[model samples]
Target: MKKNFILLFLSASIIFFGCREKIVTVEAEKNTNKGGLLFKIDKVNAPKNVVMVEAILSRTDFDTVKASLNLVTETSADLALNNIPIGAWQLNVNAYDSLQAIVYAGETVVNVQDGIITQVNLTLIPTSSGLGSIYIYVNWGKIPTTAWNDFELNPILPSPISSTPPLRCNQPKVLYDDGKFKMWFATFKYGFAPNTGYAESYDGFAWNVVKENLFDLQKNDSSSYSRWDANCVIPGAVIKENGIYKMYYVGFINSSGEWHIGLAESKDGISWERYPEPVLKANSTEYQISAGDIIKINGVYFLYYSFRYNTISTMPVQFTGGISLATSTDGKTWKRSETNPILTKSQGWEVSRIYYPSVIVENDRYDMMYMDGSGTGFGMASSKDGYTWTKTTTRPIFTLADTKGAKAYEVVYPFCRKINNKYFLYYSSASNSDMLTITIRVAVK
Candidate 1:
């Protein structure tokens, strides 16, 4: 009886210790897999008497929540939530009044990497009518009354060093950073393939061209898969993030003759090394990808690009084109919006084509300047969210006639810049007499 009692006590202690060890191990694993969020809320078109805002982090399916927090305030406030399970989450926010009635609500998707504090921002949209209508304070102030100077910087940057006659200078993507002006432009010689070159300016007008190309075609046959961009590379958008200058461009495959969105990075805004393959491609066989503009918002990279059907039809003639959006966390991997083709051909002036998007977010609103491929003009549009757009009542903000007697018949590839409270629109203008020849021009407000 005594031996049996001692054995039973030993067995009970072993089981208890084993279970305790398992509990501690599971707790440590849970802590290791945790991440955090720093959230900022902006209330636009919100009702008065909003007393509290609650943020909930839920799974992708909206089936379960991982964590949540609340802030009581009448205005925008920043809050931090810690120790959420490291994974993908959708942030849902609800603005409540003193009566506990829901006033405004919104949700945005985000990815939480291990041991990282991902920043998120939510723009609240009201669930019901309110006192003040939601208005985006773009504050772009009066449109420029001043006529664009054709001579200010026509043919802004010269042709390539190896001069081929009838030089082509088009698709200007300029960056004003660190008190200096830099540009990545597409330069095409008469018979040679098109490539991207660099230029710099200290005063934003007088430019000194970099002698070499920033991006070029691969040195292989176009038919080879290795030569994805063996024919042409054109600059799309230029942005500086975390001290690194990144360029999103369009690369054409000679064999397929289809364009794809490509990426390249530089430290000095010149001398870029491109990735081996295109980062974004067409999911459908009937469309080809084109130039894209990228902007970072709430720790997510939003890329808006143009797509036209594979029919090779002409605008105002036969075919159609539209604008789409894709989001990325690291700016490499991308997920296309399910509701794509956000902006499509609609109005008479557009003529069935809308491509070459130059987009920026100002005052919690998205502003885009784009070209209608069939027309000789470009228009302006704005959005509260990046997905849906509304064209400005005064369409074709700038047109070929706006340049007056510049022989600029067609205007394409618009890039917008705002500095010192002034707005500047940079675009490529085609010669009215010679359609093949192109020049760069700028209009300032």
Candidate 2:
């Protein structure tokens, strides 16, 4: 057999074609007392743009038995085989393109024993041998410690702890200024109807929460006129420019939760004043704005927010959407990006939604850590122009499983700040797997 390797493109549609190999089950036997072997696919070597591949395992004795694996990914996964009755086997893999044509092929031989696992490696060549040279790109960007760490620590004040554990708290926007770290977030006393709260810290660890809400559901509680932010308030981003503190926040009109981005200004970061109305509303009735983050590049303000499809099923749930862009000069009246939704959903952990973008602008690099879910994962993406983005990895940067602090049902709302060359990440996680008892937690790198 001609031996070579294949470029494994794991994202293609799998086709169940009839091969003459007479395939059998690849599943391992329960508590197998005899022969079995485990194979770890360590590398994906493939020609460019080949999106799918299949593997065939066969071993001939008095009779022939075969098993086929239809799909393989770039990520490493163990291919477990059990009860093989102790013998040598043939492993053949073929890479296919969208047209269901084989582009690359490789085969190898392995031995199986009573309790040992076998490993196989191969190099593939193009089916069209003279199709020039092939190039393969495997994206495996790992989150470095300098990027951020997944270490979890004790919660800050009014967190999962303090005087009374919060039943619900999230949308934490933390800012570092004048040798102190200040946080503005939302605390839920009436379910989704949250009230924005404030806290201060000198070192970003021990925190002091203000006794009262920062800017409540209204510009003032005494105002009887119905305001756009009357129902709920969630803090999004905070930036101080020209000695004035500007807070971009998410607001809700009623139980319908037509979320909009609103603004509030303060001098001392304690007492806040509102704009009386929302600064930005949804683009259409089919969409609902969730949260907004702000970044200033070359004296231009960039406000990026997340919006979701306004369906009946999604309205009742928490935030899940894609990140869109808008720009402003004075940081007030803004123009939407011509190419909106600069970042979007991906496969695996990010398939359901990508929202709550917290971006940091460092020179030419725009690093964004956003909420990636079905629930409990955060993803990172980088951009050069701030309009087009590429995900850092196929997986979440760090999950709640990396925290080892909260037994969380869902961990969302990532707001990141880089201070003194160290990254500070503040987000909410459920306390002990109880969704209602959500609170803020911090990690530093």
Clashes of each: 0, 10
In model 1, the clashing pairs are: none
TM-score of 1: 0.63
Taking all chains together, each candidate's TM-score versus the true structure is 0.63, 0.62
Clashing pairs in 2: 4-123, 4-124, 5-123, 5-124, 6-45, 6-46, 7-45, 7-46, 9-51, 407-433
lDDT of 1: 0.62
Candidate 1 residue-wise lDDT, 1-445, digit = tens:
0000100000000000001110111122434675555444323212355656565656643334432223443333444555556666655556567787775554555566674444432323232244211111111223445544333224444533335575578788877887556778888775566788776654344455764366545455445436667677788878888999888888875725567888888888767888878889865642577766888888999998888775545354444668888899999998888888878767788886888888877899899988887657888889998888888745687777777334576788888877545566778877657577776766655
Error of 1 at 47 (Å): 58
Tell me the deviation in Å of residue 140 in model 1.
Answer: 14
RMSD of each: 23.9, 20.8
**What is residue 25's positional error in candidate 2, in angstroms?**
71
TM-score of predicted model 2? 0.62
